[model samples]
Target: MTSSAPSTRIASKLGLSDRIFAGPRSRRLLSTVEAGLERVDAALVRELAMADSLANATSRYLYDAGGKRVRPMLALLTCQLGDGATDKVIDGATALEMTHLGSLYHDDVMDAADKRRGVPAAHEVWGNNIAILTGDLLFSRASQIMARHGEAAIRLQADTFERLVIGQMHETTGAQDDDDPVEFYLRVLADKTGSLISAAARTGLTFSNGPAELEGALTVFGEKVGVAFQLLDDVIDLSADPDETGKVPGTDLRAGVPTMPYLLLAQRSDTSATALRERIDDGVAQIADGADPELLDDALAELRDHESTQATLDLAHRWSAESIDALAPLPDGAVRDALTRFARAVVDRSR
Candidate 1:
């Protein structure tokens, strides 16, 4: 398929455009990846196009808005260790991104989020029923693309889909009586965010004929890095200005979502946290009722400056370091170095 070179924004989003292109060899690899990503973009639009005009528009909505495309980038990067970006690898990357986009539509509905990627959420534009159906349509398209790759890819997609659903189910049901809330939250992050990422990394190996030994390492690396990424986002959610994050500060807290910082604060028995916890609870209730914006804003500002927020940041660094450690088994080279930098960037990203 014909495609243009990836834009600077797309390259920066993958965390490896200008920075990694220092040497001729590195520049060539970067060009290859850029070309592959362009193909992936084309494939996404082609596959998501529908016979019905309304269905086509809704399916293409999020794709047009753009995203980090981290999953597909990981898939393409790992492919460098093997046969590079083959047609199958490109298709695999496209399918993974489609699955991710589909999940976002469903996630927005569940979270009652008004916006995604700086635009109105699909649910907000088309109502919940159409949004949910659009997500299902994308999922079906992903499966159709995966089916072309073979049974293994299909199985991987199915397993990841199951994990995504199960993770959402647990999040909705909340923790069991004996469950440690912190542990429960981490598990949810792993299944919900990490599983698909792990699959994306593995798909590179599966499609590109990479060394089989590296598969498990990359999978673990992806999962740990995903969790670390989400943890960093927890900190960002509290600290990021609206312009940086494209969402209001304390959005999750206002929605009563149990973020890592909040969970950590809840575990503290210190008197300092007692007042903070009460205020947070009150803020949640107030926000839910659309009352007392000033009080909620004050509580959010307080929590943003709290020690638990710092603790959450520290935890993110720890996980990112663990993700780097997971790559110890791989041979030293540009691919491994790029992956390392990518993991670090996940925790360090400002937006």
Candidate 2:
């Protein structure tokens, strides 16, 4: 693929701007992240290739469609605190991104999602078995990449993958009878979303020469940011334009997937909330009985405008704020400053 010059738009994707990464070195830091992302993008394309034409096409499908590069950006940004995108750092970022891409295939299969990244989901195009295999193929390749970094990296990848699986399992199974649904769901977000992000930052630090003291802080920061990002996604799921978010609104509700808003709404006993809950439940049932999800568009719009949506956004903001607080342990520097901007960017994406 031909490359374009790194522009302000690319930097903006990571929430980087002169105002945020400022002082004499601000431009330098922004340039570094842009350059690193370019390299990571190129590396991802090369690594995703295969001997079979079908495997190659399936692998590159979503990559070509486009993503925000959030995981790789986190990896690249954190690695800057150390050796500034060394070869190992680039490799780590590439592997981490592959892990994320691979997971999406499986997620789409599980969600039975029809579209992703603005196009047909792999499962919709290739069938669930093929889509699942494609996802596993991506994960296997990612594992091979991590193996090159030796035992510590391998173990880290394993632990991260474990969290991803466990998180999905919890989400699929729902909260236990004894579990606090809200708390349980937040933990699921941490495991499913936050764990991989946390690993990306940690892997970057491991591959580079970042200080040991920075590890704990970056880990907390990455995971919390992950949870916040997902929570924001819950809100977004209810309010998308389809043109902008590349997703139909209320896909979660249609799937009977209980998002933050659904859980919170279930807890409220007020008249409006109860009335809204009844409408949502009926919508969910209709979808379950094979009704088209679009039929429930009116109800989703109502839920989106309800106070529960605001409550979900507030919860996301809280997680984002906590992620920023985790950065306090890091030394005052451009990296920390940029990470603060990045965390805010995750929450601000909803706007």
Candidate 3:
């Protein structure tokens, strides 16, 4: 189905959790997230302006384009749901968002992306070097913010940052050779996508001093949801409409990133498999003309049918179940329910 299509009925049976997408809980959490995102945008604007006037203007230009700000919101809501009512979470959220933006700025330069969030990328507005410097500055500022807190918070943020860097390095270094397996993809995803999520949830538990059991459970939940999220991203990268995805289709294809769909398909087809390895080593054009579309479709179908996707779903579901059960021993309230649903929603989101 196209990206904007109201998800296929089949996804429901696949155990894609929807508990977080229903009722007043979802609405309230969404409203809270919106408010939190606005605050984050304002902070980004203020900090980007910390540069000289020209740099400030360029930063503002990047800020105006807008984004989902999902990481920060996840950090904030998880903290609140865990009964941690400190403004420190907001500070943490801002730091996380800044770090995320910094990564995107650098990623845009590396990817040679011209636009993001419907506007020119940082590298497009400023030169690549300037964008890289700005990203560095943002990352440094994030650590500074985290450092204002006690050692525990500082250590947590530091660990999360390490994971983020490791994930990026792994992605850049890993060869998409024939020897690479789907498990490698999962590891890459866990670090790249899961680290921030794990940090967000763990921050909540830490702030609240929630049960120790909840920490591992929520971490698992975040990691599983993160994997599913990235898997869907890889899927959408191949199939999503340009308008919805805010980028060109076939990005992974062009980049020679052997995403899950293609990897799964390669496992089953000799010619397709050989073409995949060739595409990784050379380029997608190596595939015979008219083969690209068929191969992409077959890969997508294989992804849909593969045990890997189900395994991803199972992991996500297990975490959701654990997150809910972990909360069962806590006080019954809207916040707890909202938190539970939020975890459920993490895996259910289409975009």
Q: Please give the lDDT score for candidate 2.
A: 0.83
lDDT of each: 0.83, 0.83, 0.62
**Model 3 ranges with Cα > 4 A deviation:** 1-21, 24-35, 82-85, 175-180, 208-213, 270-336, 343-351
In order of appearance, the predictions have TM-scores of 0.93, 0.95, 0.75
Tens digit per residue, CA lDDT, model 2, 1-351: 323322324544544464446666545677777788888887887788898989988988888877878777777778877877888888888888898999999998888777887899998899999899999999999999889988988898899999999999999999999999999999999999999999988877778888888899889998999999999999888875875566677777878889999899989999989988898898888888998888778878888888888999999999999999999988787778878877786777643
Worst 10 residues of 2 by lDDT: 1-10
Residues 247-318 of candidate 3 have per-residue lDDT tens digits of 655555554556666556556556645654454434344442424433454444444455544554555555
User: How many residue pairs clash in all the candidates, one count each?
Assistant: 0, 0, 0
What is the C-alpha local distance difference test score of candidate 3? 0.62
Which residue pairs in candidate 1 collide? none
When sorted by TM-score, best at the front, the candidate numbers are 2, 1, 3
